[model samples]
Target: MKKLIKLGIALVAIISLNACTEDDGFTFIAKEDPDGLTFANTPSGSYTLTAANADNMAERFVWNAVDFGVQTPVSYELQGAATESFDNITVIPAGNSTNVAVTVSEMMDLAEEAGLDNDPTTAEPNTGIIYFRVRAYVGSNGGNVVDQFSDVISVTVNLPEQSEEEDEDLPKLYVVGNFLSASGYGTDWTATDGVPIAAEAEGNTAYEGFVYMNVDAPQFKILQTNENFDDNYGDAGETDGVYTGILESPGVNAGTPDGTGGYYLVNVDTDALTYELTETSWGVIGNATPTGWDSDTDMTYDSDTQTWSVTLDLTEQEATDNGFKFRANDAWDLNLGDTDADGSLEFAGDNIGVPEDGNYTITLDLSNPRQYKYSISKN
Candidate 1:
């Protein structure tokens, strides 16, 4: 009876101690990771699972080690599954390291098992996704040992779709800069999310567009494309004031226009390896402002908040029903009108109706991407 009592007390203590590691409503996955496995470098892109590049490292599976709050040695194993459902699982033991790699050949096997093929005649898909996960466990995943699983990562794979026509390389210039992250476009200085400047036409050297960046001294480079950084253009340390700056092939990031910064009308000459920046000044234009439909009432820029605002008297013409729109450089080339009349701005959208005639404060905030908004407040 004493032995039985001791065993019962021991089991209770064991369950109480292990309760901290328990994760409910999950299968081999942790509810939260105090220091759970995190991927280090999983470069983005699709894969063509072919034997030609079999030995090439598809993508290195990297992650931070999991901490079960114990000193026991932890071992990791890489896992793959057909879909988000872990019903069909594949495992690759990675020993005790926190990082491992899945080669093209190995991915090819997984692809074949997932019923993907390069055959053009069959109903099987040439494109599919493979989900990945890594397991962290102590004591060889023995009974009651601490173990946790990382979040699933899905990778798109293709079996090389057959095409009769060759793909044309449409030359494009993507502006990769430090201002992107500040402006909330994407990762700073990364071509993967850089803003694009397309060629004027086929076989043209001039690339023109507008990008709103708040960096006082704009530091940037022009990437050939958004996929890879194989080709790029950047500062050659030559400048003709804020109007233009010289560019060099395969160059590092560089700044332009000294102190002038705001929305810019950019023009890039790829052949000459030079670029120009035209700082745009925005204003309210239409028949409603002090300047009738013919001219624009200039708006002031607030660098602290990165907005264009104006306080002016507006006339509500109930007769002719005239209204105003926002434009840059006192011109129609770069203008915005609210198509939905929902306080949002779209390129060359419809004219905005005046709410009422009054002395009002209007503010335009272009700091956020695709969420350009304007606010009109009566003072």
Candidate 2:
């Protein structure tokens, strides 16, 4: 009986050893190792691109097939970068192929985004080496799962010359209806003398400016071009503080002011179909100002001069270094600072330094929509 029991135990040990030895799973490896890829059509030498031939073909990059060590599908990608190490890179996929053709226009965008100037006429010729390499990987989806990179090659690119044309001026916006200095509605009663709001930025479709809306002229609509009843904007009823809520074309349902009428900053965005009204107020606040940065010393606006001014006393000892900034509505939403410390105000810029200290009258001139200026005069 003891001999039979020993034989049974020996048989079980042999079965377990066979099972463990037969469980060898498959492993993945680079078939070509990617690093050994040869570029069959990599462009060499320098090339110049221009807007005249922007749509023309620049180059077609071709590379050898990469093996993912299995029948599972593989993908290829062509990448370009400003640096040789692939830093600040842009990539284009090859679908399921090992080649890609690039256009001059597409290459121009890539060069510009890589810190090259789009205009070659005025700016110096952007002569630098652009690096290119092929990336081979498994799966078509996007992620950090990369397999290998082909040998890198470089080509020099010159900035493309583009034709210079002055940007067309944005159409003007006139205040219509009874919403300004006068109290009357309709196209005939054009508020040409009311207030002209111009575009805040060159290509922006938004216009903004200050308008004094009183209880009498508390409501208004905007007119495009001539004071014709053909087109205008009314209310869209989207949210609070939106005057041009719904557009009313030839029809009229002028929007009303949110709060008591006063000199308010009215901003209109036609593309977004929205309008905003903010009370025009300014204040000087900072560690350098008499009042600390937490609170602002209010500044008053003069309609005649079209400027915001304030006179306050400041001491060198009080202003610990971080100086001061101009804020609107006593809130951080709209603030200006001298980023360059050159006595001019930049929207959302750094704090202004107190060049010494004493009583002084500060004036902010925003008359020029493109150029805003401010002056600190010793009292």
Q: Which candidate is the best by TM-score?
A: 2
- TM-score of candidate 1 versus the correct structure, residues matched by position: 0.39
Please provide, for model 2 over 45-116, each residue's C-alpha lDDT reduced to its tens digit, 9 standing for 90 to 100: 344545433543455566656545567666877787777888677888886776675655666666666667
Cα TM-score per model: 0.39, 0.47
| Whole-model Cα lDDT of every candidate shown, in order | 0.63, 0.56
**What are the per-residue Cα lDDT tens digits for candidate 1 across 79-166?**
9887788787888788877666566667777777778977666789966788887777777565666666666766666666432111
lDDT of 2: 0.56
- Number of clashes recorded per candidate: 0, 5
